[model samples]
Target: MVALAKKKEWSLLLLLAPALLYFLIYHFIPISGMVMAFQDYRIFGKSPFVGFKHFRILFASPAFLQVLRNTLIISFMKIVLFFPLPIIFALMLNEVRSSILRKFIQSTTYLPHFLSWVVIAGIWIAFLSPANGGLNQLREMFKLAPKDYMTDKGAIRWVLFASETWRSLGWDSIIYLAALASISPSLYESADLD
Candidate 1:
C-alpha cells in the first residue's frame, strides 16, 4: 500500500510544481530586488553598497514630493470621487429597458478592463495625442488649440484618473449589479406604488 501511495503523492507534487515555481520566480524573486533601489544596481558581479542614499535623494527632491502629491490626488480621485460612479452607472443601467442597449453598455464597460494595460495605455495615448486624436478633433471643433495631454504636466493627472476610471468602472459596477439582482421584485413594486 505504501509503495503504491508514493507514486500518487509524487504525481500530485509534479502537477503542482509548475505553479509553485512560477509564483517563486515572479513574486518572491522580485522582493529581493527591493535592495537594488538602495544600492547602485550592476549588470556585473558586485553592486556598490549604498544604504538609504537613493531614498534620501528621493525624499529631498521637490519633484519627487510633487509627484507624491500628484499620486495621492490621483488615488483620491480614483477611490473616493470615483466610488459613486459605479452605483450611478448600475442605476442608469437598471433603467435601460432595451436589452440590446444594456448589452452594448455592459460590453463597452467590461471589455477595456480585460485589455492589457500596455494596450489600454497605447489606445489612450493615441486618443489623446495632439496630432489628430479624437480629443484633438473635438478640441478643433470647439476652436481650441489641441494640447498634448501625455506631455502636459497639468493634464496628465486627469488623464490618469480618466484611464483608471475606464479600467475600473465595469468590474466595480458588478457588485451593485449583483445586489440589484438579489433584490426582491416586490420591493421595486412597492416603491413604484408609493
Candidate 2:
C-alpha cells in the first residue's frame, strides 16, 4: 500500500498545485500587507511602527464617531428591518397560483441582483434625481416639492436601505423558496385534515 501511494504522490501533488498557488497568490501574500496597519506607511524609505496611534486618532475624531454611528444605523436597518422582507416575499410567492405572474415577478426582482453595485448606484441616482426623475415626477403630481435624496443626510441612510433591498430581495428569497419547496406534501395534507 505504501509503495502504491508513493507512486501516485506526484499525480496527487499536481492536482493540488493550482489551489495551493491560488491561496499563496491571492490570500497568503496579501495578508503580509496587514503589517502596514501598525506602521506609519511611507512611499519612500522604511516606514516606522506607529502601533495604535492611528486608531486612537480615528476614535477621537468627531467625524469618525458620526460615520461610525451612521454605519451602525445602516447596519441595523439592513439586518433587522430588511430581515423579514425576503421571507415574507418568499411566502407570498409560494402562495401565488399563477406560474406566469410568479415567473415575471421573480425575474424582475432577480434582475437587479445580477447588476454590479456601480450600475445599481447609477440606476438609483437617476431614479431619485430631483430634476426629471420618476420619483420626483410622481411627487410633483401630488403637489409636493422635489427632494434631493442623495445629498440629504437624513434621507441617505433610507436610500441605502431601499437600494440594498431592491438589489437583494429576490435573490435572498430563493433560499426560503427552496426551503418551502422541500416540505413534504403529506405534511400539508395532514394539516389540512386537522
Give candidate 2's TM-score: 0.87
> Best lDDT goes to which candidate?
2
Worst 10 residues of 1 by lDDT: 172-181
Estimate TM-scores for all models: 0.79, 0.87
Q: Please, what is the whole-model Cα lDDT of each candidate in the order they appear?
A: 0.91, 0.96
List per-candidate RMSD values in Å: 3.6, 2.3
Deviation in Å, model 1, residue 96 alpha carbon = 1.5
Tens-digit lDDT track of model 2 for 1-194: 99899879978999999999999999999999998989999999999999998889988998997898999999999999999999999999999989999999989998999999999999999999999889999999999999999999999999999999999999999999999999999999999999
lDDT, model 1:
0.91
Question: Candidate 1 has what TM-score?
Answer: 0.79
Indicate the residue-level lDDT of 134 in model 2. 90
